[model samples]
Target chain A: MQHEREHTLKAFDQDLDRLRALISEMGGLAEHAIGEAMRCLVERDVAGARRIVQDDKKLDALEIETERRVVQLIALRAPMAGDLRDSVAALKISGVVERIGDYAKNIARRVPELQDVGHLEPLSLLPEMARIATHMVHDVLDAFVNRDAEAAVKVAERDQALDDFYDSIFRTLLTFMMEKPNNISHATQLLFVAKNLERVGDHATNIAEMVYYAATGGQMTERLEKAGAL
Target chain B: MQHEREHTLKAFDQDLDRLRALISEMGGLAEHAIGEAMRCLVERDVAGARRIVQDDKKLDALEIETERRVVQLIALRAPMAGDLRDSVAALKISGVVERIGDYAKNIARRVPELQDVGHLEPLSLLPEMARIATHMVHDVLDAFVNRDAEAAVKVAERDQALDDFYDSIFRTLLTFMMEKPNNISHATQLLFVAKNLERVGDHATNIAEMVYYAATGGQMTERLEKAGAL
Candidate 1:
């Protein structure tokens, strides 16, 4: 009986490790997609943007695989307490990551539209904004893997910078549009790209909250309130 | 043992009923918020917009409650197969509905921004767009409660109309902005409002997919492909 118990425990651990690996793979793809989409925007590389859109399918597949693994883990292992919560978090985070990938895809789709407007001033701010948003995705997934509630909180805090960047870009683009009405359509695309990046930041923070909850078994309502105050 | 099995089944059904009720409440709040936000936009009712923002917290609270109940249902019942899938679907749908509520709040936030440009021509189309989106939310939640996969599919199909509405508004607003640079600032707000409505449609479709999956235990990839073709 003792040996049997040990064997089951080892299998459950392996299953969890696989789940985390799938999530990490999905996160890496989403992060890469963001960078590539922004790069494509800057360089007017429509082919690369197309590739990013195609690559989103892989992330989608991984999210579905993650859900399958999570379901199997719960049914087979019946993980208790923190483990169970972690499994649930994994499920939710995979969905969020997939949406992050969609945002990247959305940004990619706009690349061809901005071929002429690539030199716009607000365009320059976007790569940096994308960099920050991508980092949040990276850091939050790391927190999830390590079950580090503190790191998760830190990641959640970084969203403010992204929000500030979005606000600045919004103002900059509005001015650009007002000054040059001909640029309205393309500038509008950039506005959405900025909004998409802002939403990516928000989604990362959401995953951070889930990670914190899974690790600490407490609601992050206070942290959210604090962040709101910021 | 049979009596105990029957008792367990009864409790599980009651738990599911509660889960469905919570989701319905969240859905209703989200749908109502969409309508009110659009009304506030047309009427220039900043106070009503603020009220929509404040009321979003209640939806958020309900989502958290739904999550808690789902966790309990999973842990205590240890549901198998379809029941387990339903529990997981409820978890995901709650998150999606919460986001739908956030989109409504986002629309409301812009209500104050558009105070000066309330009479814009494109503004007329928005209330109808919002109406359709709200109906989608209402119908999809009904599908979830009834486990009606066909109804869910119908709800998903309606998203195309929302997309069409968005496209027309996008063109109209671009022309309006180019004709009057002063309108760019407010026109941009309307663009985002249209985008928000489009996303609400997408989210309602997302919930419909979840409902379909929970009911049929099949992926919606084929339907997605068909929709993409559309």
Candidate 2:
């Protein structure tokens, strides 16, 4: 019986490791999807946009598969306290990943709509925004694996920068719309894409916040601006 | 041991019943918040706005308390299968409730601005939108407690009406702003408030969809569009 208990513990560890790997894999696909979607926007790469849409299929499949594995672990093993938290975190992580997939897909769909806007005036900082979001996802996943609360805190802090970027985009788009009403249709589509990307960043921040809670057993509810350091 | 098992089962049932009741209470609070918020918008009721803002603290505390109880359940009972799903669902419901709280706050914050417009027209359907959302939450919570997949399905189907309402508000506000630019500030703020209310309805729809999956063990991805059809 003792040997059986030890084996179950080993299996539990293996399952959790695999789950984390699956989440990161899904995160990679979503990050790539966001990158390609924005690239399609910048370069008018319709084919790239098509690729992001197609790749969402795999993300969707993996989300379902990961959720099932988590469910199976619960029903099959009756997970204890910490394992329950871990499994619940996996479920929430899968949700955030799937939503990131949707954001990328939304950006991809808006690519064709922006074709007449004459190259989108470069959107100067949005790529940086996407990079920050991608890095947050990657860092949060690593932090989750290592139980690194400080890393999670750093990721959470970056949300203020993301917000600054979002506000800049809003101000810029509002000016573009007001100054050149003719550009409203094209510019509005771009605004939606940017907003979607920003929301993706928000989701990453949410995951990092969850990591903070999981790692430190403390809820980090204070605003990043109030906290002041990354 | 059998008596002990019976006692444990009874205690679990009591917790489940309490959780269901608390969610219903939170839902009612959120629904009232939404209604009063719209009243503030239409009537420019500063007092109503103040009331909504004050009540938001209650919703926030309810969410925190709900989460604490759900997490405590995980620590105390290594729940499996349906019990596990219910606990996780409780957590998810708290997320939706918090978001609803935010929309209410947005609506309340806009009251001082709405007073500036003085008899704006788009306020007509704004309350309807909030009402539909509040109804969806109540219906979904009922479905969850009763395991009524059909009720969940019905609520899921009505999602588009809310979106359609959103689109209507958008067009009305944009047209109003263009034709009567004096109302731009108020109209724009109301536009955002309407959008936030619409989003609350969407989250409620998401919860209804989750309840459907929980009750029926069906895949949710394929049904998002169909789920919009009440």
Candidate 3:
């Protein structure tokens, strides 16, 4: 009976490792999707943008697969306490990562439309904002993997910088639109791209909150409020 | 042993039912938030808009409570197959509903900005679009409660109409911005309001997908694609 219990415990560990590996894989794909989408945007590479759009399907498939694995692990292993939180957090974060991928694809779709328009001053901010957003995605997933609540809190704090970037971009784009009617369409598309990046930052923050809760079993309400205040 | 098993099962059912009730409560709050935000926008009721913003905190608190209950239920009960799906679906839907409430608050935040702009042509569509989106939230939550996959699919299909309304509003607002430079700022705010309503529709559709999966254990990829094609 002792040996049998040990074997079952080992199998449970393997199941959890597998779930973590799957989420890490999904995270890598989502991060690449965001990078490629931004590259396509800055380089004016329409084909590259199309590729990111196509690649989003892989992230979608991975999300479904991750959800399946989570359900299977719960049913077979019946994880408790911390294990249960880890499994549920993985499930929730997969959805958020998939959403970040969608935003990347949405940004890519706007690339072709912007190709004909002359470069505007606010376009310079796109790469920086995208960089910050992608970095947040990376660091937050790392925090999840490491079970580091402090790292996750730091990631949540970074979102404020992204928010500031968005405000600046919004003001700049509005000026561009107001200056000339012809700039309206391009400016509006850029506005959406900025908004998408802001949303990606928000998703990253969401993941950070989940990671904190998964690691500590304590709500991050006060911490998040503090971050927001900052 | 058999008696113990039956008691445990009964408790599991009660837990699931409790989670469902919490979700329904949250959904009602979100739907009301959207409606009140729209009413505030149409009536130029800054106080009403402020109320919607304040009410969003309740949705946020409910989401945190829902997540905690979901984690506790999974840890204690270790539900399998259908029960597991129901719990996770409740978890996912709570996040979506919370986001919908946030969007309503975002729309409300713009009301004061719009109050100074006087009436605009595209502003008329905001209430109608909001109505459709809120109705989708109501129906999708109903579908969740009933385990009605067909009704969820129907709700998903309705998103196309919201998309259409958004497109019409987008074009009209763009025209208004182009026709008069002074209209740019207010029209832009209206554009964002329309975008928020459209996003609420998207969140409602996402809930419908989760409901369909929870009910049928089958993906709604084809149905979603069909809706998008329309």
Candidate 4:
């Protein structure tokens, strides 16, 4: 009986390890999608943008598979407490990562429209913001894999910098649109691209919160709020 | 032994019912929050907007409780297959609904910022778009409660109209900002407001997809895409 129990436990551990690996793989794909989408914008690579849009389907499929594994693990193992939280967190994080991929795809879709418009000053900020957002996605997923609450807390703190970048870009875009009425069309699209990056940052923060909860079984909001106040 | 099994089944049913009730309650609160936020924006009710921001905490608390209940139920019951899907769906839906509440709060927070700027033409459409988005939220939750895949599919279809409204408003705001450079600041804020409403519509669609999946044990993306193509 003890040997049988050990076998089941080993299987459960493998199931969890597999789930984490799936999330890491999905995260890598999402990060690549964001990078490629931004590259499409920077290099004016319409074909590359289209490819990112097409690639989002793979992330979607992975999310479905990850969710299936989560449900199966929960049902088969009946994980309690921290273990259950880990499974649920993986499920939620996969959904968030898929959304980040969608945002990347959305950004990519805007590239073809912007091709005809002349470059504006604020256009330069897009890639920088995308870089920061992608980095957050990377670090937060790593935190999840490591079960590092401190790293997750640090990731949450970094969102403010992204917000600041967005604010500066918003001001610059407004000035550009105000100076040249014709700049309004492309400027607004850039505004959306910036907003999408900002949202990616927010999703990263959400994942951090989930990771914090999974690690400590305690709410992260209070600590985040206190950190914000500081 | 049979009697014990029956008792366990009864408890599981009650637990699921309780989860549904909590979700319904949270959904109602979120709907109220959205309405109040829109009302604040339309009426320039700063106090009311402040109230919506504060009230978002309630939704947050409910989400935590719902998650805890879900973890407990999963651990205790080891629900398999369809039953596990139901629990997971509830879990995912709670997070989505909470986010809808956050978007409402975000809109409300913008009200104070908009107070110093004069109204633009597109500002008039904000409340109308919000109404549609909130209605989608309501109907989607109802679909979940009733296990109505048809209703969920219908809710998903309605998001297109919301997207249309947003596109029209976006163009109008761009025109207003271009016609007078001074209109840029207020117009940009209105643009954000409209985008937030559009996102609420998206969240509603997310819920509809989850509800449809829970009801049919099949993905809704293909159907949604076909509908989009039509």
Candidate 5:
């Protein structure tokens, strides 16, 4: 009986590992979708945008599967302590992954409209913004995979950089519009593009916070607040 | 032992009701915030916007409390079947409410930026869009509270109204900039306001879908396809 009980413990452990692997896998896929979507924006690649939309299905399926597995694990194992933390975290992280996938889809959805609007006067800043936001998404996922607190902290702090880039784009576009009235059409679309990237940055920050929770079983954002950091 | 079991069942049912009430309260607060934020936009009332931001703390606190109670219930009761459905639905609904609050907060944050700028051409459509979206949020919450499937379906179908309004706002803002070069700054801010409303509309639709799920337990949006239906 004792041997059988030990065997079941091994099985539960395997399930936990599987859950982690699936989440990380989904996280990577979500990051790829974000990457290609950003690439679509900078390059004006409609086909790439289409791919992100098409690929979202797999991410969605993975998300639903992860949810089911977590619930089942909770039910079957009645997991407590660290196991419970992990199962709950998977649920929250899956929600975030699903949303990140949606953002990727959103970036693609704008491609068709933005493609019609011709390039804005200051194109470099928008793409540069996308580049940084995309990299932040990548870093947060990597941090999660390696359980790296420092990397997660880095991702969280990088949100301010995205904000700075957004402001720069806004100011540059403002000047461009003042110079040429017709630039308005392209500039508006670029604004949406920048806003989307900012939102993506926000989501990455959210994921980083989650990783902080996972790493320490304690919320790190609170620490940031206590330290008088925004 | 029999009496103790009966007491446990009664306590679990009461807990479920309390969870329902808690979500309804949060939903009510969020729905109010969205409405006030929209009114602030339409009236260009900075004070209203300030109110939304201030009230958001209340919503946030409610969210945290709701989450805590949910985890506690799950840990203590280990509910199954319908009881489990009720608790899980509360968790999902709380998330939807929290996001709605965030959207309201976003609208408020943008208000200060737009207060000085005269309401541009696209600004006209925002009020209508906000009205439609807020109604959707209210209706969805009503559906959840009353278990009214018809109301849920109605909210789902009305999402297109929000989309059409967004497109009108988008085009008008574009034309505003093209026709009058001086309106670029105001035009851009209005653009952000419209997009924020559109996003709030999406969150409204998300809540409506959740109402559908709680009432029907069938995931329609998955197979429904994203037809750019706002």
Candidate 6:
């Protein structure tokens, strides 16, 4: 009987591991989409941008699969307490990651529209901003895999830099638009791209909060209070 | 034993009803927030906008409560099949509804910024668009409560009109921006407000899809194909 119980436990662990693997897979695809979208933006690669948009469908499909797995895991295992909470968190994270992919797709869709605009100063800030946002996506998923709450908090902190970049970029674009009225069309597109990256940063922070909660089984704000980080 | 089983079934039904009630409350708050935000925008009611931002906290709190109730229901009931799927869908719909509230808060945040600029033509189109988006939220939640898949599909169909409003408003704002450089700043804010309303419509459609799936025990696309609506 003990051996049978041990086998059941092992199977449950395997199910959980599979769920985490799926989340990591989705995260990898979303991160790659962001980087590739940024590249397409700077290089004016319309075809590459279009491909990124197409690739978002994979992320969408993965999210559905993740949800299916989560429901099946709950129904079959009937996980109690922490295991159940983790499963639910995985479900929510998949949705957030899918949204991150959408933001990347949004950025990509603008590439064709932005092709006519000559190189602008604000464009230089975007790649670095994308890098930060992409890394937050990367590090947050790693935190989920390792169940590291501290690492998740650190990832949330990085959003401040992305926010600052967005503020600076917004001001620069506004000035640029006022200086040359003709720049309004293309400049508007760039503004949206910047906003999308900022939103990606926000979504990454949101995921970090979910990860922290899943790992510690407590609200992230409580963790912050204890660490005097709030 | 039969009596006991009946009692258990009734208790589960009550739990499900309570869950539905929480969702309805959240949906109402989100729908009202959208309308109030639009009113604040058009009237330049900075104080009202601030109140709307502050009120979003209640929606956030309600979502947390809904998640807690969901976890408890699943852990205690160990619901199988459709019951489990419906519970899961309820959890997701709460998240989506909370996001809709956030979009309203976003629109509210811009109210103060727009107070300085004179009224633009696009502003006139926004209230009607918001009304449609707000109604979608209300009708979709009603569909959830009623388990009416057909009603949910009707809500999804309304999104095209919102999309059309957005496109028209976009062109109008772009033309305005190009015509007068001074209009760029305020026009940009209006553009984001329009985009926010459009996003509310998208999220409402997303909830409609979820409601349709939960009600019909099938994906929305399948239902659409069957009805020749696709």
lDDT of 2 by residue, B48-149 (tens): 898888889888888778876776675576576677777767767776777688789878987986675657788787788888888887788888888787
Error of 3 at A36 (Å): 1.5
For model 6, what is the C-alpha lDDT against the true structure? 0.90
Q: Tens-digit lDDT track for model 3 on A1-230?
A: 99998898898878877877888888898888888888888778999999999999999999989987887777667777888888889988998999999999999999998887676778888988998999999999999989999999989889989999999999888888888779898889889899999999999999999999999988777766776753
Largest DockQ belongs to which candidate?
A: 4
Candidate 5: pairs in clash: none
On DockQ, who's better, 4 or 5? 4
Q: Give the DockQ-based CAPRI class for model 6.
A: medium
Clashing pairs in 1: none
Candidate 1 structure quality by residue, lDDT tens digits, B1-230: 99999999999999999999999999989999999999999998999999999999999899889987887787678898789879988988999999999998999999788876646887898899999899999999999999998899899989888899889989999998999888888888889999999999999999998999999898665766776844
User: Which residue pairs of candidate 2 clash?
Assistant: B157-B228, B157-B229, B157-B230, B158-B230
In model 3, what are the clashing residue pairs, if there are any?
Answer: none
lDDT of 3 by residue, B157-194 (tens): 89988999899999888888899878888888888898
Expressed as tens digits, the lDDT of each residue in A1-230 for candidate 2 is: 99999999889889988999999899889888888887888888888888888889899889878877876766566676667667767877887888789889988988777665575562656777788877877787788777777787778778778878877887786666566556655665666676677777778878887776766556667534467642
TM-score of each model, in listed order? 0.94, 0.83, 0.91, 0.95, 0.89, 0.95
> Fraction of true contacts reproduced, model 3?
0.59
Of the candidates numbered 1 and 4, which has the greater lDDT value? 1
DockQ scores of all models, one per candidate = 0.61, 0.22, 0.54, 0.73, 0.52, 0.61
Question: Each model's C-alpha lDDT?
Answer: 0.90, 0.77, 0.88, 0.89, 0.77, 0.90
Deviation in Å, model 3, residue B122 alpha carbon: 1.6
Candidate 1 lDDT at B29 equals: 90
Candidate 4 structure quality by residue, lDDT tens digits, A68-128? 8887787778877788889989999999999999999999999998887666677887888
Q: Please identify model 6 stretches exceeding 4 Å from their true place.
A: A225-229, B225-230
Tens-digit per-residue lDDT, B1-230, candidate 6: 99988888788879989999999999999989989999999999999999999999999999999988887787677787778778988899999999999999999999998897776777998899899889999999999988889899999988998999899988888898889888888999988888888998999899999988888788887877888978
Please list, in the order the candidates appear, how each scores on TM-score for chain B only.
0.96, 0.92, 0.94, 0.95, 0.86, 0.97
Q: Give the C-alpha miss distance for residue B212 in model 2, angstroms.
A: 1.5
Which has the better DockQ: candidate 2, or candidate 4?
Answer: 4
Task: Please give, for residues A91-112, the per-residue lDDT of candidate 6 as tens digits.
Answer: 9999999999999999999999
